[model samples]
Target chain A: MTEFQAGPLSLSFGRKQVLHEVRTEVLRGGTMTALLGPNGSGKSTFLRAVAGVIRANGPIMLDGMNLARMSVQEKARYCAYMPQLLPPPVRMSVVEVVLLSLRLGGNYVGASAAMERVDAVLASLGIMHLADAMMGELSGGQRQMIGLAQALVRSPKLLLLDEPLSALDPRYQFIVMDALKRETVLRNMVTLVVLHDPAVALRQVDSAMMLRTGRVIASGVVEDIVTPEIMAEAYGVRARIERGSDGAAMVSVEGVV
Target chain B: MKERSNTESVQRALLCRRLLIIALLLSGLIAAVLWNLVCGASHLPLDLLLKALFSGPDDHLEGSAGVILWQLRLPMVLMSAVTGLSLGLAGAEMQTVLDNPLASPFTLGLSAASAFGASLAIILGLYIPGLPSEWSIAGNAFLFSIGSAFLLEMVVRLRGASAETVILFGIAMVFAFQAMVSMLQFVASEDSLQDLVFWTMGSVTRADWTKLTLLSSVFSAVMIWSFRDSLPLTALRFGDDRAAGLGVDVRRVRLAALIRISLLAALAVAFSGTIGFVGLVAPHIARRLVGEDHRLYLPAAALSGGIILCLACLAARTLVPGEVLPVGIMTALVGVPFFLGIVLRREKTE
Candidate 1:
């Protein structure tokens, strides 16, 4: 299994440091980790830094290879990042956009093979029908799914998704999370996703990291990280973890701290 | 499995349609080129034009038809095609890199800067050193256009290479250069002012064999370089962070596109004066025809540009019977209505 380790990543935008010397435990492949934080907690910034979309003062090691030493193209072979924003409604077709990701990532497959891979990814995400649709004509939720398809089409070793469900409906949210889980296991990839909803994190992720004010306040299993004290400290909310009818753990926020 | 095959068929059909559109555009360009050659001030018969074309420029023909075909018509026709291709290709890259549909060589101020350079040469007799007196204006225009592009590149390097920064800076440069040209125009002698006005109107009539060769070579080289980066440029349309996630070095790609735009725009403006609207309209037409896949879009846009300019050249010749209106004015006349149609149609659809 592949191992993804990011450590001591410090990033600054002008005078403000968006990411502190934050570090993560050795996240292994075939599992999903939810990056949980309140607003302005640097969840997106952390993902951008680790994905090498933004420069940060730190080292990222993927399967014992120093990602810092690798070129952007080389690093992309091992990692695919989905930004938080939905893709603007461009005039390109859905399949063309996904194929563009594969091509730009330097995964030069034959045309048939590339189409096959793209088809498989889209089918797995239940968006196969959208392959021929123009992105400009798709709804915001559909565009979000297209973005996910693009990130998964290349099947990189690591997936960094920032709020992949923000524009998704509840139905699509479950669909997307399920597909990401299946893909992560089937491809043996490490997936780190930024999720704002603690309940979703508790239900969907194998582990969770809680951040506040650019610092990682807690990190471990989902149940361990979503505690009352940590929630109070991180989100300024008095919260309780309750068992649902289906016996899944859920975070119920009571009031402000 | 059935759905997958259906989707694949749809994709195949789309590709075929794009190819057909490109074929149609090529044919249209050929027809326009032929029409441009035959319909000048003194219309030559098709047979005589064909005979002169077959004999080539080297053979001395006894009739005026050969001289008119070789010396007068061919250079202007070829110049229209080359300048349109350069501006169209450059505009496609510009729009993609800047992420703005309105972005073009004219929008980026290259033409205005070149016009300013031409004004200086005409008004103050300022010319580039070592150029022959006849070539001094073109040389000065080329140098100044290239200089403006260089300054723009330096600004992009120093500041962030964001699309907004480049476009805003370019718009500022447009106004600045335009103001400079107006200042020069104010102090010019009546004859020099008339000459400057004519030059700014842009004419394919000024084309010569040497300028054609130089622009064609530069265009071919830049086009090859552009096609090499087609995939990355396509990815850039998705936005900068996502393009970076897809392994494109966004800043580097933007800079490279800027350099190519510089060479193409500067050279075209230098040789053909300040032709407008082809760069702005051609890519939109190409996009409407073939979508935004740069692999097809670049060539389609270039072809569209070439056809537009060729038809403009033809119209410039035929519109007033004996008088040749400036081709630049013709493009503006045609382009503004077409541009409005695109905008109005988009409004209705959206």
Candidate 2:
């Protein structure tokens, strides 16, 4: 499998440094890593840096290739990032959106092959039926699925998703996470997802990276890093982890610290 | 068996829709040309008009009908068609680039800048000495239009290019040049003022073979260029962030589109004066008929623009019989009401 490392990364907006010396690593393929942090903790900034949407100090290494030096088109080939808020929807079909994403990544499969790929991605996400629907009429959760379909169609080696489940209900969150896991494993891709719910992260992800105030607080096994003491420190809440009915770790916040 | 037939039926239906639109536009273009020829100040019947068109060169034509068709009507009809096609194509790209439905050369102040330039030529007699006096107005208008585009480019470079920024600057440019044009109007002699007013109102009477050849050649080049870049332009419709994520160089594509848009608008305005409404209205009509696919949108927009201008020319000539109202006035009279209806209908739906 591949290995991805982002080390000593620093980013600033004007004079205020948002991310400083943040370092994280994950299996470069066949895994989903949950990025855990409180709000305003530079989680989004760090993801943007890795996606090459913004400049950052230090190299983002994907299979030993430095992402900082890669052109936008080249980086797009290896990495795809879905932002938290999609742009206002245009009157385009779902399949057209996916096909556009493929075209943008310089993947020039002929029209029929491109449509085939769109169908495949939509089918994989169970959105095949909505392929002909207009994007403007879709609900937020459905749009999120379309966003994911767009990202997945590119077949990126590294997929960065920013708050992808924020708009989804319980059922879609699980479906989307399970699909991400399956696709990541199937394609040998490194799927880095930003998730706020630690309990959901515990159930869905193989590894976790926790950041607080522009720094990485912990990076390792989910159980070891998501302790009550660490939660209280990072999230400023007194919390405890307990086994749920499904035998997976769940975080329950007792009160504000 | 069922699925195959279903797919075939869908394909056939789509092909029919495309062909129908194409046929309608072709017929409309032909009808507009013939109507424009027959309905001028001196009405030539359909048969005489056909004979005039088919008759030998101007030197060998039998009578005044041939003389009128060859001399007065032919160039005017061609100019109306060319100006509409250019402005419509430019408007389609402008709306895509700015992400605003109402944007066009007229809205963006390029036309106003060209008017200001022409006013300087007509009112102040300020023109380059080397060129003939006849060409000074068109040449100056062309230069100032390019200047307006350059000003836009500067703004984009200074404050990172965005749709809102481009539109805001364009509106500002429009007001600035309008004020300048008004000031020129204030200072002009009565004769020159009338000339300036008529030029601003727009007319195709200035058309000649030389100007038509130049405008058509430029229009053809830009159309081919836009057609080639239709894919990237379609990507831009989703917005800058999405386009960039898809690996499009958003700044580069927008800048290129703006440059070509400036050239197209400049050439149309320089030759035919500041003809408004066709650029703004045609693209909206086209989008309604063909959806947002740029490949279809561009051609449909071009045809719609041509149809509107041709009809405007027809009305300008025949509305009062002998005295001709400016085509620009007729377009605004027709366009504003139609635009309001579109807006009101949209509001009701929403």
Give per-candidate clash totals. 0, 0
Query: Which docking band does candidate 2 fall into?
Result: acceptable
Model 2, span A33-97: residue lDDT tens: 88899999999888888887777989888898898788888888988888887635666667667
Q: Give per-residue lDDT, candidate 2, residue B166.
A: 80
Find the candidate with the highest DockQ and give its number.
1
Candidate 1 global CA lDDT score: 0.86
- Candidate 1 lDDT over residue span A68-160, tens digit each: 777788888889998988998887899888988888777679888988999999988888878999998998888988998898888899999
Q: Tell me the DockQ of each model, to 2 decimals.
A: 0.80, 0.42
TM-score of each: 0.93, 0.88
lDDT tens string, model 1, B141-241? 76777787767767755675665677778889989988898788788888878777766788888888988888899899999999999988888888878
